[model samples]
Target: MAVLALDPHIAPPAIVLQVADRERPAAGGGRLLPSGFLSTSGSQIVDAGGRSVRIASIGWNGTDSPPGAVLAGLWQVSYRTVLDAIVAGGFNTVRIPWTDAGLDVPLNGYNDRLGWIHTSLNWDLVADPAPDANGRYRYVTTLQLFEKVVSYAGQIGLKVIFDHHTNEGTEQKNGLWFDLGPGSAGRDGGVKGRVTAETFKQNWVRIARTFAGNPTVIGFDLHNEPNGEKGLITWGGGGPTDIKAMCETVGAAIQSVNRDALIICPGPFFYAPPPAASGMDPGFATPSGNLTAAGTNPVKLPIANKLVYTVHEYPDEVSDIARFDLAQSGAAYVDRMNRGWGYLVRDNIAPVWIGEMGSSLRTQADRDWAATLIGYMSGDYGNQGGPTFGPGQQPISGSWWLIGPSNDPPYGIQTEWGIGNFRSEQRDITDRMLMR
Candidate 1:
């Protein structure tokens, strides 16, 4: 593994060092230190004044309709509508979920999918086999759209985190090469497995090569939710070798090409703690629970010395049936936090950003659960050093980007399902998270 040197032109702002002293009363008598920047064993980010504000980012998944529709007149709103909402809602950053398919796929030509209209088209295709009536090559459309999205966000004062959501299929479901399953060209545990190391390197190389020198882009997430496969085997470490290699390969790729952005690697299954090496049986654990077992690779692999470990937390997953069953009341919900998220944080060997977490108002119970979870995120749960890793602090940065148009239906589904037509609320989440 190789470490990257910071470009002299883009040297990070000088970091302020806050020393830990046991004698100072202002330090909360060694309980909690003041709200000043402190040095850690990793990279540093500072403001213009050389102060590190606890990065309180607001993020959301940014994919839905095609870039053409977004730039064109889909729902009669520009991509800026979402960014504008973010600024209005007090946010400063955005995580734009982009797929490589738009670039990699061979397009035949540039024909408007919708009725003939003249407007801005955000997506571009690579023109592999030459453009046909359908449109340009997938890769070309992707690149054009990415540039536009990043440029637009930068113009509006929002930092952009380019997330490569899918490598093979669309960004909606089990499309990554790894999730292809049995008899597929890119099945799990195979050389082309979705989370395998080789695929990680290849995809990232293409991505890093493309985005080199772009300043607005913040970081790269190696893989998302790298678990939940039956009869699947990991690399030499018995954990997700592909996912870990992704951190190294993608980190190195970005560093080799563009060395300014941070590198983020997520834990398995929405950041759930992996099970023991023996693996968690189906009857013993839920679909979202860790399968790698308790003593497996806790931190997968570090991102070549400069990066942040991202973890996702949700009430639906992580917690066992006993805890969730009792979550009817606020007290039980807090208990679930301790047993679920708390354990993972303590045991996991990385500082984390709760990458994705949100709930909807489908039912009164659901709303109550969501609200309670939000309160915990806002710092209400007392520190409980129980179970595996012991007490730990909640992620200081994350996304509350999901907002539903109706109480029953979740909004921002576009980011997950829609290939090009991303919803405004989804983009709004990105704007908020990228806030400085």
Candidate 2:
């Protein structure tokens, strides 16, 4: 293991420095941290050995869907095949998004909601279980299936980031973290039911205990994009409804079960109008919040060296893409990021991971935007034809929005399965991803 040089001006916070000195024991009389576990040091994510590692990852979505299933079933490929494809695609991590209800219920119970869309289980690829009292075969539970997925991913040398994709058992469209309602409808106007914050925390506690010692399961993304009614999107203010408070509450719970677990908190989602006559669109929105102000303070956890701030970015979500041209320059784009979540890295407060970002690259403008964003992540300021970060400012890490078999416009990274060919739209994006 080798140690990378950190920005001298941007020292890690006191809590992180203390953890590195105490928890990260020098191995073989060398500065190497350890292997297996991962923790944050300032704007960098280091392995147990303390070597800097970037999370060039892709989201393996589907856990939020009925039955906690992954896209592997839709692709008719084994979960191993999907994991292999992720590694072969030059990614080091996989973000697995799952729902609380899906994990608590039995596979069959949740699958019933899949109706006609559910794929036949590839039993050989998954877990094997004993028959029930009636001598009938019983499929593995969703929790068991996820454990299998994590185990296989580790076998293939891929890091797993468990994401709480939703509180409901069905599709995730509601922006709230734990929707406790009398009759709340989903984004599709269907009632998916509700869950209390207490129930949400309990499920996470159970999840943390389940994979407490698993090194492959490095990070626990507390919630997917936390946005909804006014109270739900609370940043640092808004009392108990504040997302920062929720993160601290849930993060502490996870750490109690697994101290080494990295707690990732996604920023709030809101629209920010672009500069007047700046050629950018007005309806531009991102799952990032400006935490540079006095009221919007940075998230501080009781535990050390484990908190990671995250945000989601998308092109279509922006108000106007035509005006926000990336071909000419990336100044506007970089500024938008700064106002969103870049401040964390810029100020050296904590490691900021762009948890989700994707584009179809359907048009030249889309392709340019992708290139600019990728260049920024890679620390290639010149590639975007824009101003670069200052001496102490470090490049940030990010993961693509999704990788699935379905060709759902720009979000899908692959059209088919089995690690063959990715969609045409992914050609440019894949090239920019860091292998290690």
Candidate 3:
């Protein structure tokens, strides 16, 4: 791979938000009553007057690694280029994915005096206890890079959501998530492994505590995409992993440390399935007899008010949108979401956000599907009473397109798979909808 530029640019001015205790207007009510700064064992958010901000955001894993690409140095000059483009395109938030282990080198772009930078540079070359020894456990680079990114986004009015793509390893299948334990079940299972479950709660605590006071951090995603047989069931138990239960556990961990930050938890199948056990994977449900062990226990945590259910709608197999040529009409697009997209977000009461969407799909059919899906979720989801935690309760709070070097020309600048085409095109579409 070619080495891109890696020179630290001077940091921009930071936003100085007033911290106070005041009641902000709710979506549609008298208002959420006044309260003090949101506090937790790990950290605190909210101003002295009690106004909390939600992260209406986007996801970009650049400045890090792609499935088949080499690791880019954190200070790579393109990091700034990509970030500048994203901000210029009008996105005010970014979900940064980093390996759980840590980074081995120092990012050299900003003035070395940034607080997050100085505090995060420990020079520890270990991926122990959690990520093992492979390059996966490294959070050193993630810590430095994300802090800078988050700080920068704050300067530009964007929020930040930190996500852990995997623990550590050389290769991954289809760019999935980290499982809890060992073997195929844990590695490529996409949060199906025990290692994930084992370490997740603690991870939340650490992360929540780190950004406790910064409202610019929208929240933390416990895990990316929960999948596989051993993965989370809707409940908690030995039967399999229970995403609902995982939410409770991880949510509590975050709440324990910083009660004010929001918690965004993706549904099973990465938002690919509905509540019905039929469309869902057998493993995601508890074992036939372990009903009690399933994660059915009610979640009674304080952060429940701030909980947001996350799911994705990519156009791979199973998406009804892909079955027909959707590039044709508005009605077809609406129909696809009503059938497939609607099913995913309608069941939950908490706000629903399309955490990940956009495909490297290659066809007019695919592109049409993308346009419709993006339109439906960002526009229609709000029209329909999907789920929302904040005042408006809009079902589709946010959406982002996946990007990589794979997105080269021709289709360039218009689609995620074709590079240049997607950035400009997605930005145009997104800007029209979001107005950021």
Against the reference, the lDDT scores of all candidates come to 0.42, 0.61, 0.44
TM-score of each: 0.61, 0.77, 0.61
Tell me the deviation in Å of residue 158 in model 3: 1.5
- Judging by TM-score, tell me the better candidate of 1 and 2: 2
**Superior by TM-score: candidate 2 or candidate 3:** 2
Greater-lDDT candidate between 1 and 2: 2
How many steric clashes does model 1 contain?
A: 47
lDDT of 1 at 311: 53
Tens-digit lDDT string for candidate 1 (109-184)? 2344421211122122122324335442332354555565666555555556656565443332432324433423
For residues 124-198, write the lDDT of model 3, one tens digit per residue: 212222433432232334465556556654554456777656555323342334454532354542433334545
Model 2 lDDT tens row, 151-261: 867665677888888766554456667766422332322644557777778889888999999888889888876653232344554444567777888898888888878
Q: Pick the candidate with the highest TM-score.
A: 2
After best superposition, candidate 1 residue 264: deviation in angstroms?
1.7
